[model samples]
Target: MVRERKFSDEDLFLATKELLLDYGYEGFTFGLLAERLGVSRSALYKYFGNKEELIMEFMMYELDQFMDKLRKINDYNRFEDQFDYLLELLMNHPQIHQLIEIGRHVPVNNQKLKEKNDKLDGLHLDMYQSLVGFVQQGKGEGKLKPHIPDTLIVGYILQSFLVPNFAQIPHSEWVQSIKEIIRNGMFTDDH
Candidate 1:
C-alpha cells in the first residue's frame, strides 16, 4: 500500500494557481486538483471549500502583488515613464496573462467570486485613474504637453503596450522614446 502525502497551504495555493492556468476556472475542480496532486478530494476540501473560494483567494493574492508594485514606483521622471515601467512589469508576468485569460471563463455561482472579481476590477480602474492623474500632474508641472487630455494620455499609454506591433520593441528603448515623444513631438526645434 502507498502512504498518503500531506499538503500544506503553500503547496495547495501553488497547485491551485498552476491548475487554474492549465485548465482555467471553468475546467478546474477539487477532484481535478486532488488528482493532480495524487491526493484525495477530501484533502482539497480541507484547504478550499469550493472552487469559487479558491479562485477568489488566488485573484486577491495576485491583485495584492499588483497593488504593491504600483505603490512602490517612486523614481520615474514622467507619467509615461511610470506607464512604461508598469508595462514592463505586465509583460514579464506570463502567469498573470494566463490567469487573466482563465478568469474570463471563471464560473459565477455565489456572490463571493463576483465580489472578489469586482474588487480586483476596482483596483485596475484605480490604476488607470492614477495614470490619468499622472498625466494631469505632468501638464500642470509643464513636463507634458498641455494639448493632450488625461484620457488620451492614459489611453495612448495603454495602447502602446497592448498593441502587438509596438509591443515588440524592447521595454527600455520603447519607454525612453515614448517619454520623449509624449513631452516633445517628432521634429525638434532644430529640424
Candidate 2:
C-alpha cells in the first residue's frame, strides 16, 4: 500500500535548498535530505529515483523563485535603482551561481533529465531577456553608454557579482564601490 507523504513540497524544497547551500551538490544526498526533513531515506526514495532527480526538482523550484524575484526589476523606476536591486538580489543568493555551475554535472542520461536541463537553459535566456530590456531602457535614457553593446553591458553587470570581497570590507562599502565602478569608469573622474 502507498503511504501518504509526510512533508509538504515547501518543506522539502526548503530543506533541499538549505542542504544544497550548506553542503553543495557534491555533498548533498537523499539520506541527508530525509534526515533533515525528519523522514526515512526510503520515503525519499519513493519520490525520487536517485539523488540527481531530487536535486533537479529542487533546482526547478529555486529557479522559479529567482525568476519571480527578477521580474521585480521592472518595479524600480530609476536605472540605478534597478541595477542596485539586481545586485542586492544576487548578493543575497550567491549560492545560486554555484548551484547552477554544479547543475552541469548532473548526468542527463534520460529524457526527463534532458528536458529539465533544457528548461533550465531556457529560463536562463529568459532572465537575460529581462535584463536586456533594462539595459535598453538605460541606453534610451542616456544613463548607459550607447556606443557599447547591450550584451557587453549586461555581461559586465552580471559578471560583477562574481567579484570577491577579498579585503573583507564592510558590505555596504563594498557594494557602493562596485556600484561606482559599474556606473562610472574605474578611473577617476578627472581622467
Q: TM-score: which candidate is best?
A: 2
Candidate 2 error regions (>4 Å): 1-15, 18-27, 31-41
How many clashes (backbone atoms < 3 Å, residues ≥3 apart in a chain or on different chains) does model 1 have?
Answer: 0
Each candidate's TM vs. the true structure? 0.60, 0.77
Measured by C-alpha RMSD in angstroms, how accurate is candidate 2? Answer: 3.2
**Candidate 2 residue-wise lDDT, 1-191, digit = tens:** 98776898899988988887678778888889889889998888877778888888888778778989999999999987888788898877766666676776777888888888788878877788988999988887888889999899877776776777788999888878888898886898785
Candidate 1 residue-wise lDDT, 21-107, digit = tens: 777777788888888677898876666667777777777677567667765554676655765676666555535545655665666
Q: Mind sharing the TM-score for model 1?
A: 0.60
- Evaluate model 2: give its TM-score: 0.77
Runs in model 1 lying further than 4 Å from the true structure: 1-5, 74-77, 95-98, 111-118, 131-191
lDDT of each: 0.68, 0.82
